[model samples]
Target: MKLPRMVYNQPEVVQPVRTDVLIMSPWLAPIVWDGTYNLGILNAQYRQRKFRVGITIFAIKKYTVFVKKFIESAEKYFMVGQKVTYYIFTDRASDIPVMNLAEGRSIAVLKVPSYPRWQDVSMRRMEMIRDSSHTRFSHEVDYLVCVDVDMTFNDEVGVEILSNLFGTLHPGMFGLPRDSYTYERNPQSEAYIPADEGDFYYAGGFFGGNTEEVYKLTNFCHKAMMVDKEKNIEAVWHDESYLNRYFLYHKPTKILSPEYLWDDNFGIPAFLKRRRFLAVPKNHDEIRNRR
Candidate 1:
């Protein structure tokens, strides 16, 4: 079933009833939409429809512990009343934690090969998701939410985020000027974005959309990375740089606030009173270097 397209702007006099939507940046890009969404209303609207939503995560090697915490938090807080499926892509399917899911929620474990380097693991995720969306997910789910396993939900994460295409503002870069964004600057790479052009630097850790749109995004990123591989030109931030490039040309239908993917290690800012999911602090040296 096709979802309604979200209206970006309304008549000036009508006034936005939702105060969580922030217009802070000089670019005037709608960065955060926290209180703007009423999940109760959205839940009631979609609950009867029984939309099949797929949440995909990769937890190779040491990341298994994180997956456990993520799923625990997700089962309790993520899309609580909706029809949701956790598509866990892991090298060790046996490591997936067994949990009692709510009535309409379930888990699907798919085995993937382990990679030696974390960078390769991150880059290959795009290819795997793209291929699997066609082979596995498209047949089962209507929408797909791809996220990093290192985070856990702290509040409601429901249909408010659903759109034809959506991306979350990188909490670290949302306050920076467009030119300060860490976009791929090299002219030779397919992910290159000029310093002057960028709506927002979206986090690579979380993003989602309808199954078909997400498949297109993943496929595009995978192809771009391959082109960079041939030229021995890796973007400064790997797949993330490619994602920023993609959204610059094709703006997302909805832009989630940093609240959706915050880093608790950084502490909450004054403007951010509520954080939906927090990235638990991890010893990057240990997790990434061990592999």
Candidate 2:
């Protein structure tokens, strides 16, 4: 692919972008944040490739109410100008709302059954994604990005996030000591990480990789959940626990800062330049039917 001559400032190796936050991981992977990379350069590089990105989101039962807002906000902020296919997994396809999507963006509904518990609903995503990756996602898209449906985009989530494999920092878990990280501690479950072991507790709400890497990840997590089920053990945080354990060993090619996955409960800190994607405030007991 011939990249046309374009005027942009040459990157200076001596001067770093954000001195406060860790710009690079121990493994040399870039920790993405605002001011880290030039969007013009990234957009031109990726847009020329004509990449196909498929984002997976699940809206089932009570979660259906979040669909319209998610789609509307997504249309305004997510992967603008890229070929995006939102593979929405929902029990009730009719309940999924329709909206005017932008050019090169569309939606595909994958009908699934509703789970009895909200925990099951969240944990089952690994299995659902694994199966879909094998039969559908692999052939349809170059990359698979997954996110929780209950959240909405607040800022640009563009090609800057695309990588061979990527994980977002858990908003509540960041800036805390490793010991304080809520990694699964049960030795019996496959999601267990030893007391002294952990890199970063990742947000399961958002993560992705190329088709092959995502397949390998979801496959491992799904099978681990099955083993725990057979032994009558469930990890403390469901899919998120499994995800943390996986990233601990596997490591991601790129890591997104907390800006990509902030909780609605917390105020945006001064250090954060962009509040990209955020959790929509909701009552846990009321929405999940915990009552």
- Candidate that would win on lDDT: 2
- The 0-to-1 C-alpha lDDT of every candidate, in the order given, reads 0.86, 0.91
Q: Candidate 2's residue-wise lDDT over 24-58, tens digit each?
A: 99999899999998988888777667679999999
Q: Model 1 — TM-score against the truth?
A: 0.90
Candidate 2 whole-model C-alpha lDDT, 0 to 1? 0.91
Q: What is the TM-score of each candidate against the true structure?
A: 0.90, 0.97
Task: Point out the worst 10-residue segment of candidate 2 by lDDT.
Answer: 282-291
Candidate 1 lDDT, 120-176, residue by residue in tens: 899999999999999989999999999999899998788888888889999899778
Error of 2 at 278 (Å): 1.0
Clashing pairs in 2: none
C-alpha displacement of 52 in model 1, angstroms? Answer: 1.0
How does candidate 1 score on lDDT? 0.86
